[model samples]
Target: MSTENTGSLDTSLVAAAAGALAVMCASASFAGVLADAGWLIPALITVLAVVGVGVLGRRLGWPTVGVVAAQLAGLLVILTVLFASSSAILGVLPGPAAIAELARLLGGTGELIRTGVPPVPADPPLQALVCLGLGVVALLVDLIAVGIGTPAVTGLVLLCVFAIPASLADRMLPWWSFALGGAGYALLLAAAGHHRRWRRYEEPDRVAYALFGRTTAVVAGTAGVIAVLAGSVFTGVGTEGRLPGSVPEEFGGTDGIGLQPFTSLRGQLNRDRVVELFRVRGLQQDSYLRAMTLRKFDPRTGWQLDGLTQGVDANAPLPLPEGTTIGRGRPERIEVQPIGYRDPWLPVFGTPVSVSGMGRNWRYDPAAGIVFTQTNQETRPYTQQVIVPDPSPEELRAARGPMPIDPAYVDASGISPQVAELAQRLTADAPTEFDKAVAVNRFFTDPANGFRYDLTTAPSTGQDALSDFLFRGKRGFCEQYASSMAVLLRSLGIPSRVAIGFTAGYQDGTEQVITTEDAHAWVEAYFPGWGWQTFDPTPLSDGRTALPQFLDTALHPPQTPAPQPGQPRPGPVPGAPAPPVAGAQPDSRDVPQQRREPADRGWSITVLALIVLLACAGAATPLAIREIRRGQRLQAITEGREGAASTAWREVLDEVRDRGHQPRDTDTARQLADRLVTDHDLDATGADALKHLVTAVEREWYAPTAPSDGTLTDTLEAITRSLHHNAPLDLRSRLFPRSALPPWRTTP
Candidate 1:
């Protein structure tokens, strides 16, 4: 290829390599932030590969070869990183032993969400490697089709498409994710090549390039800033269901029922149910179910519960119960597992004493045992710690007293008479109001004799749901049981309302994590002497009791031994050392000693000295070589009889000057040549020969090229003699008299 074409190709290759580097950097940075896995090594390798490809293009003068090499290298690096980081990134390592466990977990929740169920005891490493291999194949195919194109833009698009899916798949078919990434890389290379080809025929305008570069930088920077700000806001609100910077107002005036988390469809449904069921009671307090409190709301999503505002005071006290003494025991941790439906209202036992590990906006309801926060409706597991007052069985039994009828309960003007008649019939047999309340509770709780628990579907409306549950469909979920019990108690003039909370949760020794499937609603009846007490009208299953199986496991995970009274407890995990030991004294042996040394004699100083020495040595190497060559050239010039020796010398010096150097205005060609030889340590013969060549150049410029054959031959021989001997004049020195000279020169 012509020199011009060769240069163009090299430039294109450099551009392509730079584009690849940018893609690799973006991917690496993103992975670092999201994956938290060991992805650095692969990212570094990919970067190095891009650099290598760039260097190879420059050295070999071939863009195509460089592009191909880089694509292959990038593919390898991506695969390696995916495989190595799969375990940490996917949260599931491949192995036969883990496949069954993974399958169970995935099947339980993953299936409901449209994700593929993973096999039991999977082979994480192999899965990852296979996925990576496939990704490479896909990438190759894409590159072959698209050709080399704009690497950065293409890579970014690919990243957006792959991020979520890859993350999810990495837990199962990890190898598939790798394959997908490979495909992305290949597509980027192809796109970059295509862009280059198009640009060749239609040259890009300089203004456009500048505009695009600036625009990309500005937009990306702006987006990054916004993401950071929004993330910060989400972290602030805590769990009180309150938005940051917003003051809490009681819901619907004085009756104290707080606002519930109501962002998602499910949450909205729950809220509507609560409002409909309790609005007419007048005695119902403004109650809010606290899930996650948001002190920050995104301008985009508005104020929703997913955003968590951190740093709020989580320990603030709520309105207390009359004559209730607060206890200082360890808090009971509750975990709620998500079974697919998204709702902000988390159910818990009635009358929570205190709550811990929740957002700041969350307030406790001493009357109802519910915690609520304004949170996003996305399905995910949530946890919190609550203090439940320890009421002895005797206290609970003896605490029952006459029910005080709220004067507000006397009227039901707007309500249908049928509803009132049904309520009275349900509570009719009992004499005391308390007895009537128990009768209503027993009617729904008797599953074998009356009610049944079924989650197959929701109840249809039009006909009264209570009558249907009583006459038609004997089986029902918590909503039916709780709804029926509430209506029945209302019939007898005893104040009663529905309560929603998780029935049970998975146990981890002493802690319970409630899953979303455990969503339940029951009833609470007020007793004049004691207060409102929880009543689950839902019957227990044959294999289960009131408590859930998961709750039992969670509340009490396996435990390790406790340390002495003065010693600190072990870490959260079993058999782990305590983070801080009680009464353990600090030792002086662990202290580090400081050392003082002379700064002037440090390694940096030594390095500087060595560099100076090497530079001096470099300056001498060319001089010695020139001297040896000049001796040989001089002998040839002297022996030739065709031309004068002086003429030969002049011709040689002129040739040296022609390459790239010209003397200062004040100096003649010979003078300049002589000065260069001396400064650069050229030998006597080399210096003299250079001086002679300068004279020939001057002579030729003035006298022309009419020398005799003998003269020409002699001149030619002289010029050829030491053309490669003495170092040429420094280009910088010749061009700018005041500038420092280059270290060494090579004769052409």
Candidate 2:
């Protein structure tokens, strides 16, 4: 290629690099201001990496696709390597582990987005996603603006990125988000365009330079004007149920109620201390005591229980949701008594068929199974009659509802992009609503797919909690998992809501004394015939499947009838079946309690065993290390080399020692050689090698003017080969050479 062509290519790559940096800055600004700075670091890294690779590829005379591919492939590798530990284990560069790590990170990023709000400290997964996204943006900028010479097309991407943060609030960000991005994009386009024209002419012209400068100024000025206009128009333009900078007080925007409800929600949810709030009695089996239902979900804020409330009581038969099936469940009774906090919402085991002993101020919502008081209800005992649904997963999916009953009942348009996609992908294979619910429940509850039951892992407040839990977090207690499933179900056009309260607690014989630790949340899918069916996707510590609904079926493999015309009916299991009913609520019948988990045996013993092994290994490691250090110290003293030469000698000796040829404190040069010859079954050549190494080392250490010939190193190399062949069974030793480290460092 001619010098002119080479210069043009260089100019194009340089322009592309500039465009990438601009786009990276534009996109990363959102993460930086909304989230912690950790997210931006990877984006910066991506820009640098893209620039490096693009330049390299161009210089190497690669095609456009090759250059872009090289940039993407190389940067992806770098990102995977740099952050492998965050998402992967058994790190050996790229492998199954690396891919798993990448998937894990992406999944975690999704979780953070769903479960956490903006302004939280950026985690590894979030950072990785930002970097990966920036890499793609950079590649596109390179391809469109630089490679294709349509530099203006790249501005569209940068502008869209700039719009995100700008739209968050009235205006929290400075003008630079727009200015920096727009200026960089314009400069890139102008430069690339001008250089291409100049290259076509094969020479520089003053008039051409003047014309280019004029054009560049116009584009840059236009970009600046547009950015300013965009900021002015879109900034602080958020409406309710949208992604905004702030939400109303009712939406828990100020205190982060939607995602972080433990503040006033449950006294036990505190990090420092857990306070018992309530206790339950008169139940054959254990069940959760619900505080509230987040039926109204908004992406701008999150699922809110702050929606409109309706008043109902004894005189009013506690209005049931439309199309609710009656006799599908057996009647169960639970008595609740508040202790630490005077929580207004009533907690029930299942769908409240009837509520007795509550004051007149209490209002009921059939959609959420919520009973709230207009004023604070005193801490008093109340008994609730619940209908525990025994509908099969098939029945729930086949549920039919009154068309357009209430928009509030099936309202779910606010599901975030990440969460919607995940929910869609997860339930795509399943054709029915119950199948989707079951699929989602299985996915969320399974440990292998990156979900865990951890109360300590708080859902990040302010952002979409479901996305965060599913992708980035993977470890949250009931609230996150339940909300995630509920939102997914809603997105799939299935009515689902999260029930927050206490799970089954320590049974003090007849009375189950519920505690703060029992505080939990789970999804309840709205079924037409069975009403709201329970689906707890939070994996419990016990061996029992978290999906109690599916556990029995899985164990006994239920037989099913042929599919019906509309949708198949997954009726109640034969032995535990309840008659289909015609009442507004479930028809009362004989109820048998399900078995509960043993209080003390829920924690995993396998994890405990691993912990014990690790602790024991840690304690014993120092002592074992001390002995190794003593041997290495003695060996080093016997060798007695110093300075840089010592490093090389030590390296060679460590290799020899690692191959099962242990160094001895007493062995001299002659003794060690003899031992080596005997151990290796060395013929004349191997023996000669040992002899040569001894002579060379002796000369180097003891003689003032040792020979500078490379023979010394050569002999040591031969000895290394001999040791490898002689002790082929100790490959672990070669990988982890104990003697390579210094004495004090190794000696505990």
Candidate 3:
């Protein structure tokens, strides 16, 4: 092969590596969008495997179309091995089951992308999506840079990879990622230009190649340094203060700084990590901190906040609920400090009698039991003298007829008929509104009723959503439970609303620290004389949730049925107990068990090994077959079989073609010999061997004796040795020999 061809080969290899590196650098921008770095290793492996396949195909002299096909096949196998191994054959080859599994993963990832927030958990589906997406990107990079021989076009693919995280996150790309990607692109451009320079100079001088290489390195290094400095100035990755890209370890509602309970609640509860939102000092009892309340229910939108309610100045004493008087019950004073929380509505422990140390913009909505401001909650602490009234079951049952609250609170419009009927049936025997509320709560929290807390369901509201939750699914987190129970209460003509806030968080030292994981939603039923009272129907799997004192059976025992004369007293009704359920207030020292299904660890490792093994084997199969074929031809010549001289000449042609030199179809034996000697600059031994081979080829065709020589193998070896000496074969040429493939499979 000529020096120019060699330089082109070298450039292709360099471009392949550069493309892979560039892809990885771009993928690093996802750090700002994923909750964790778990997706990185899988994505990197996928890109490398795809690029490796393309490089191998090009080396083997396969056509661009063939290389692309091989890359796509390899990508599929890799994904199968990594994500759908259990569904594949021997965990290496993709089967029908594997395809189905892949489709399922794709669907799951698409759903998460649509419904989840940025920094969503890096689950298996998301990781699979990242791997699949980056694998295609790597294939594109290789096809453009190596197959089409254009490295510059790969910038578009790299940009697309970086754009995903940039669009999802409200911040600039990480500086290091930008710098590394810039460096990769610079190296690609420099390497791509190297071959053109060699072609222009028309020289095979070692000094020229060395000089060009050194110059390219210097240019790439200088560009990389400039990129680093520029990125640092613009992105602010490691700055002390918060920047646009530096998202805090906090959770917000659906809309920025405002609680949109239905979707916001799901996002917070499903967060990958817990973040402290507030710290409370002097909390007297377990209470649900109120931020806002949703009273408007629409079939299409589910539960929404009562947007028309106005508030009075929070600095002055707040009025109590209508027709309610301050009892002699002792009031608790508390101070709440916003830690990492960002929301317009302030968190208050209970119905506030007086609030102090807040800005003038902060207002108190007595109807909603919410303290609010038009702006975000200040980090500064605020004091509240709040009252949580303890009403007896009899008092609560008697205070029910109708409250003076807005009629909309009890409006049951748009509720599904199935949900309404189900609620009526569950509470048919109950005599009072409080009993009906308790019956509804038991229907959800009761394990016997099959209501399990699950976060996998997508957030939705309306009559259909309620029907799904209450009748068919029977599984959901706090949002579903709260919305369903509130609507069910309204169906029974009781004034109720869904309250959004934090649960009574676990005590840390002297402070009650409320975390984003503690964010919750529950029902509040209004009694005629008393204010809105709390009722939690959600069966939380986590043990941090505390039951209200009114629901504690130890304080107020529920009535049990009498036993018959002949039979023993029946055991306590399953799922009917108010408190002391499996998920209610476990010992604080106990570790909470995660509700997510555990991954199949042993199966995963086995499949991963299979995938890597299969990918390596696929790359090596062509080279292995080529070697076997070469051995058979050389054996025929050694045995002096029929047409041994022709076999020797044919082998010589393949060897030359394998090394990037293609002989013309019209060239005669003598002409081919002359061209090989002059082009390769073969030594005396190779020249003599080539002369003999050309004479033998002519003799084999023209001479009637059918020429055969015992030394044919030796002569062919000499010519091959000379060819190697003139332009030594490298590992790449040996592995991806173009002559091993059919003419149609190669560029010729």
lDDT of candidate 3 over 1-748, digit per residue (tens)? 6555644435456657777887787688778668899998889889989999998997798998999999999999999988999999998999999999999998888667643545678999999999999999999977765555555456556655654565454345566776667667656654543422222223345323533464445545654553444333323321112321112333222321112343323333444456567899988777888877887877654677665355788889889955455343448999998765544567787678898886667777777777776532233578989887887776777784446677888899877677788777877767777788888887776656667676555344533666766655665667778888898899998889888888988899999989777878888888887778888888776665666666654223667668779988776442233333233322223233333322222243335334533553455455545544555676577667888888888888888878778888778999989998998899999999999988888888899496466677668878976887786656566546778666643342
Across 1-748, the per-residue lDDT of candidate 1 in tens digits comes to 4444432334344344434443443343223112334434444454455445444654565566555666565554444444433432353334443344434443444222221211212234323333333334334323322233224324323333233222222122233333434433433343343333232322335223422443333434433442233222322221122333233332212110111222222222322112111111111111222332221212112122232223223245444332234342235544444433333344433344444443444434333333444443232344544444333323443454444433332222333466567556655554455555555555544323434565432354444444555445555555566655655565565665555444443344443333333444555555555455556666645322352221222223456676888988764432112122233323212211111111221243235334533443354234323322333343344444433444454434444444445445577666776666655556665555455556655666556553522333334433343343444334332222221223344342
> Candidate 3: how large is its RMSD?
17.0
* Model 1, position 196: C-alpha lDDT score: 32
CA lDDT scores, all candidates in order: 0.39, 0.57, 0.68
lDDT of 3: 0.68
Question: Across residues 107-168, which tens digit of lDDT does each residue of candidate 2 receive?
Answer: 87654543232344667777787677777777777776666655555655565565555543
In terms of TM-score, how similar is model 1 to the real structure? 0.43
Better of 1 and 2 by lDDT: 2
Best by TM-score: 3
lDDT of model 3, residue 280: 92
Decreasing lDDT order of the candidates: 3, 2, 1
**How much is the lDDT of residue 47 in candidate 1?**
47
